[model samples]
Target chain A: MIVVLSGGVGGARFLQGVVQVVPQQQITVISNTGDDREFYGLHVSPDVDIVLYSLAGIVDAANGWGIRDDTYNTMQQLTRYGNEDWFLLGDRDLATHIHRTNLLRQGKTLSEVTDNLRIQLGLDLRVLPMSDQPIATHIQTPAGLLHFEEYLVKHRSADDVQDVVFVGASKAKPAPGVLDAIKQADAILIAPSNPIVSVGTILAVPGIHDALHEASGMVIAISPIVGGAPIKGPADKIMRGLGLEVSAIGVTRCYRDFLDVMIIDEQDAHLTREIEDLGIPVVVTDTIMRDDETKAALARTALQAAGLTI
Target chain B: MIVVLSGGVGGARFLQGVVQVVPQQQITVISNTGDDREFYGLHVSPDVDIVLYSLAGIVDAANGWGIRDDTYNTMQQLTRYGNEDWFLLGDRDLATHIHRTNLLRQGKTLSEVTDNLRIQLGLDLRVLPMSDQPIATHIQTPAGLLHFEEYLVKHRSADDVQDVVFVGASKAKPAPGVLDAIKQADAILIAPSNPIVSVGTILAVPGIHDALHEASGMVIAISPIVGGAPIKGPADKIMRGLGLEVSAIGVTRCYRDFLDVMIIDEQDAHLTREIEDLGIPVVVTDTIMRDDETKAALARTALQAAGLTI
Candidate 1:
């Protein structure tokens, strides 16, 4: 089995390619839950929903998030009720949150709810949250600490990040089957997602990072930064605020502890020697996924980097 | 102040007329809470919303419930998630439930949440739920006892109703202003609603009934039935199932204890003397409210029956 650590839109787009190269049954996704938050009392797992919608072929392709043809009637009404309309919640997308919230309230863990959603959406691949326990990613900014979503979505990530903290990481244990999927996998691929809030939060979970080191399978991560900038999101701004170089090398440093191969874009090939000097192998390639062909090709390169035959 | 005890569509329609006759500020709506239920963990007060939407002039006039131009995207999507779609929750109407649920979770009483909604909707009238505590109306059917919504909305009142029960009524207290509104009103008008579940549920609350009896104001009821049948809903079916006559006399009997006067449709003029024999005065009129003029006229008649000059 192939295990992929993923975040939101970028991670979801990357997985679309991975599915093309590998059979659905052979893949397992350990999705980031730090981006999860309660909206109007409904638990919304942004990252998990993006992956689910993308894989189910229901995601709005243009936005790389939410369901296609979704209506904003609920959001518009919420605005009329004097509610903050910073976070956009589409009508169809609300079903996922409502269902998940109801199940969670009924004593079902996040993993169980995700499994039920996967089955209902007709997905063959397993998708698991990093941890069943609630963990919020908060970005420490010059203004004040803001929930990761407030900084990213509400404030449009305009705030300068001083530090990032995973609120419940210390007490949160990996969800059932998360560590097992990492250990039993033939290879592990980390999608090109925001390193600090997405992949970083997953690694912060105590047993997960240790399991990545002890696993027999090779671990390869596709860098989110291309040509010293994130393909999407505020990865560059956050990395810079945290005093890290905004390059593939900076991303490599974040996961260098357990990550075996670092996949960098051809634009950053010049930094190969610099990344390799950190004791991690560098696989330089064209990592910008513009279409299905390119996404599938990038997935193939990451699989090869993991020592997989196909 | 004029206090109107209400149910859903019928009550809401009657309220529209009441507003036309009396200034909005002088009206207090005591809406039934027994029809309230949680859908996907969101508290949905069907009766309360109807009254709010109607009074705010945003109710779907065609259906007599929900907001105008509301979409069912949320319900359709929930169906895709394997949720029972019998309860049709409109996307725009969901905002009220979402907001109310969030506040209730925060330890705010339903009365407080309702007040917020009323003010946000720009409504000058006071809309109070019958009670702040959880109370559900259940229909004891031949098949089994079902929640009022299930019996009405889901099954379309297909089951034979043996009796109607107000679950949690014993412990439930009237909302902060409910009893006071009833006691302090110049007149208490029972809207043309389902007597068995709508107005009946409100009267089931212990203190509210006593307040109506102890109050010096006249208590008047408008017959929901015309001739031998209700104009809308399954009032006749449920009334007959519970071994009550499906006519104006049956409605008069329901409120006869505290009801000082009743206004019946001209079609039921023959039964006026019979209702009067039960020690209550009767006013027969054209009660079919097809337009604003008719609704206002009906409201004026009820007000006049309570010895009001207008």
Candidate 2:
């Protein structure tokens, strides 16, 4: 089996490529919960949903989040009720939040709820939450200490990031099957997602980085950055805000301790030597997943870099 | 001010009539909470919503519940998630449940949450849940012990109800404004709602019955029954299941202790003497609220009987 550490939209799109290259049943994804939040009391795991929807081919491709053709009737009602509608929640998408929140309230762990969702969506691969405990990612912006969702969605990531804190993270343990899956996996792939506040928060969970440190297989990550900037999202802005270099080298450093192989985009080919200088092997490729072909090709390259013959 | 003890659909329509005659600001509704149940972890107060929607003139007139032209996108998603979608929840209607559940989780009382919903809906009058604490109405049917909505909505009232119980009744105290509203009301109206589960549950609260008994103004009731059967719903079925007379006399008997006057349909005129014999005054009219005119007429009669000059 192959294990993957994933974040939101970008990660979900990368997983689509991974599934096309790898046997679906052989994959296990540990999705980041740093972006998880409650809107109108519904526990919304934004990353997990994007993964599920993207995998099921039901995601709104244009938006990279929520179900395609979904209605916003509930959001309209919430607006009428004078609740802030900054974070858009579609009616069809609400079922996931509703079911997940309900099951969580009923004492089921996040792993169990995600597995149930996977089965409901007829997915072959498993998607486990990184941890069962609630870990809130609070972003310190000029606007105050805003939740990650507030920074990303509400503020449109316009504010310069001051700091990121994953509350309740110290006590968080990897969800059931997460560590074991990593230990027994033939390869571990980190999706092309934001390094900080995404993969960064996952590593902060007590036992997860330790499990990665001891993984028998190579831990490979595709650079989300192309030409010294993220292909999508506010990764560059956030990294710059946090005083981190905004390039493949910067991303490699985030996972440098446990990373075995780094894949850099063709545009950043000159940075290959610098990435490899960190004592990690580098694979040069066009890492941007522009279409289905590019996504599958990237996945194939990541697997091959981890010594998987495909 | 006038205080109306209410249930679902039928009572909501009656309230529409009430609002037509009485000034909106002069009205306060003590809505039954026994039928309140958690749907997918969201607290859903059916009767209170019905009353609010009806008073705000946004209710589905034909169905007597839900918002007009509402979509079922969320309900469709719930079905896809393999959850039983017996109780239909419109996408717009879900906003109320979601908001209510969130506030309740934040330690807001049902009264406060309801008042907030009232204000959001642009409703002028008060709509208070009968009690701040939860009180579940359970129905023992052939399908075993089912929640009120299950018996009513799921089974479509097909199964024979063996018993109707207001769970948590003993511990329930009247919501903050409930007792006070009734005591200080210029008129107390028991809307044309189910005696066994609707208004019955309100009376089941500790201080509500006594408040009605000591009401400064007339404690009046309009029988939900029009002839030998209720205008809508399983009021007759549940009444028969409990072995009570399913007619005007039966509804009057349900409120006999604190009832000062009862207004019933003309078809049940023969039973007027029977109700009056129990020391309550009676008025005969076409109690069915089929249109704006009928509803307004019924409200006019109830207020006139309460000695309201208007």
Candidate 3:
């Protein structure tokens, strides 16, 4: 099994690349649930769905989230109900959340519900939540601590982060098969997701970081940050808030203890020596995957960095 | 205030009449919840939604249920997951169920959630579920006991029902304002709905029957059966399952104790003497409301039976 540690859009896009280079059944994704929230009573798993849609080849390439060509009739109606429409939920995407929420209400764990959705979406790769338990991400800002979604979506991530908290993570147990996938993997790749709230929150779940630390297989992570900024999202501002430089070297420092290899974009080739100084192997390549071909090529490079052929 | 006891399609149509005849704020509907079930963990309240759609004038006129022009794309996709599509939930209708299910999971009672939906739907009339508790109508057939929707929708009521069980009725409490509506009503009219499942289930709720029986206002019922058959739905077969004749006289006899007046179809005028013989006043008219004009005329006749002038 090739287990991938993932977040939302960035991670989902990278997982799409990985799938292109590997058999569906050979992959397992341990997704971050920190961005998950209950809106109007529906459980919204932003990261899991992004990955699911991306892997299924139905993600909106232009927006990098939601289904392609999905209508917004439901969201428009929800707005008529006086619902805040800052976070856009397409009609087709609403169905997935509805199904997930319904299953969760029936007492099915997130893992089981996700499995059902994957099967329904005709996806073969296993997508597992980092933990079955609720782990909400909160950002302490000038406006007070807001839920991660509120900061990222409702506020458009315009607020500066003062502090971050992974609520419920202290007691959350990893979802079933997550630890096993990491332990039995030929290699584990941390996708180019936001390190602070995405991959960081996944590692916060009890026994997960430990499992990676003790993994028998090689662990490689592509830097979400390239040169001195995030390729996408608010990772740079968030990293700066945490008093860290936004660069490949900074990303390597975060995962240095567990990651065996760190990959950086060719633009950050000058920082290769600094990343290698962390005592982790370095792989320099053009890591920005703009299309399917490039994504698969990046995936191949990451696997090769772990001493495996695609 | 005018309180109408209702079921689904026939009931929604009748509610359209009642709302047309009376001021919206003065109309309150106590909808049957016996057909309510958790479909995929969604608190599916078919009767409440029908009444809501009808009162809002957005009901699918052809089906007499669901939102007008609603699509079934989500339900069609649900089939790919091997889900049985016996319950035909339209995409727009699915949004309502999804929202309701999510709220219920968040610990909101059915009554509260229903009120929220009513307001959201822009319905002027008060649409209330008979009770917040589950009071499923189970049909005991030659094959086996089936849920009310399963028998009504899936099998199209083809199975011979041996018995009808209002499961949990004895333990269910009337929804908030239900008994109060009965007490404050100028008159209460039971619509031409399924006697066994709809009106029967409402009376089955612990204190509802007694409240209706003792109310100071006149209690009238429009017979679903005309001549010797139901104008719509399976009330005829269901009444027969309970060993009752499918006639206006039989309907009068079933409700004689609490009924002050019983409205029969013009075709059943010959049986008015028999119904009167049972000591219940009778008003014979065209009880089948096929259109807005007919529905409004039916409402006027029903009100006249209760000695109310429109």
Instruction: Give the Cα lDDT of each candidate.
Output: 0.93, 0.90, 0.87
Worst 10 residues of 1 chain B by lDDT: B206-215
Q: After superposition, how far is residue A36 of candidate 1 from its true place, in Å?
A: 1.0
Candidate 1 positional error at A284, Å:
1.4
TM-score of chain B of 3: 0.98
Q: Mark the regions of model 3 whose C-alpha exceeds 4 Å error after superposition.
A: none
CAPRI quality of model 2: high
What lDDT tens digits, residue by residue, belong to model 3 across residues A1-310?
Answer: 7999999888988887898889999999999999999776678999998988887778888888888988766666566555677888877777777778767777999999999989878989899999999999999999999999999888899999888899999999999999999999989999999988999999999898899999988999999998798988899888889888889888888898799999999999999887777798889898988888889889999889888876
Regions of model 2 farther than 4 Å from truth: none
As for candidate 3, its clashing pairs are: none
lDDT of each residue in B154-248, candidate 1, tens digit only: 89989988889899999989999888888889999999999989988998898887888898889999999998989999999888987889998
Query: How accurate locally is residue A218 in candidate 3, as Cα lDDT from 0 to 100?
Result: 95
Q: What share of the true interface contacts does each candidate keep?
A: 0.87, 0.91, 0.25
- RMSD in angstroms between candidate 2 and the native structure over all alpha carbons: 1.8
| Predictions: Cα RMSD each | 1.1, 1.8, 2.2
Error at B273, model 2, angstroms: 3.5
**Candidate 1: residue B301 lDDT (0-100):** 94
- Candidate 3 lDDT for residue B306: 82
- The positional error of residue B210 in candidate 3, measured at the CA in angstroms, is 2.8
